[model samples]
Target: MTIPEQIEAYLTSQPQAKRTDLRALHALMLQAIPGGKLWFEDGKNSEGKVVSNPSIGYGTRTTTYADGKTKEYYQAGLSANTSGISVYILGIADKAYLAETYGKTLGKATVTGYCIKFKKLADIDVEVLEAAVKDGVGMTGEN
Candidate 1:
């Protein structure tokens, strides 16, 4: 299936409340990065083993590994976790940016090196989240 279709299927498979939150977040991500490329990762490794939750991604970046191989991936990602949701902001040079800048202000969310996680949209400040996402996208030079 296409990325949008895969994302829809992933969201549809979520519990009702989580699905609602994910849908809202999906819209918010699009608004933050209009015309950004869309992506869907089925959380499978090359062997097709499930490695993580399915994720809906946005934007693009080229990443080079220590082994000298390079690959392109999303600049931001959204996924439903066992407890709630996670938004991954990639390409930040400073690992502390998210936590230092938005951790306390984001309400009941956990701000990690590249991820903002919360149980629901109502648990956090959407505006703060948006700002963080914007900053993240800027860090990747994706906007």
Candidate 2:
């Protein structure tokens, strides 16, 4: 299934959510990252697909960092019932600086070594996120 379809299926299963809400959520997720690839993984048990856990997928981007380093980071789509979506800078070496600088706009978000979780797309600051992505890519030391 396509990303939008996956997102729609997730939204439809939610209680009393309007179509517009789902559209808005999808748009925000797309707008949060630029020039990224979308990925999907089936969330199924050995026997059959799990009704509640549909799939896991997200977008990924790569860029150069301030220190002339390159890296890649991924942002995942949310389950309809999820309180928020997660932003992962998997090889981030400087989480503290990024968190402190970007936390003001994140509002109630949490940050760890290489993960940032925000409940709503709106809570994230796109520019800061982009910067974080670049930083992560650079620190990763991966080509």
- Using TM-score as the measure, the top candidate is 1
Name the regions of candidate 1 deviating beyond 4 angstroms: none
Tens digits of per-residue lDDT, candidate 1, 36-102, equal 9999999999999999988998888888999999999998999988888999999999999999999
Quote the RMSD, in angstroms, for model 1.
1.1
Candidate 1 TM-score, C-alpha based: 0.96
For residues 3-91, what per-residue lDDT tens digits would candidate 2 score against the true structure?
A: 66765666666555433444564455455444455554445677886655443334654567899997654444434336555555554
lDDT of 1: 0.92
Tell me each candidate's TM-score: 0.96, 0.51
Candidate 2: pairs in clash: 70-137, 71-137, 84-119
Clash tally, candidates in order: 0, 3
lDDT of each: 0.92, 0.55
Report the number of the highest-lDDT candidate: 1
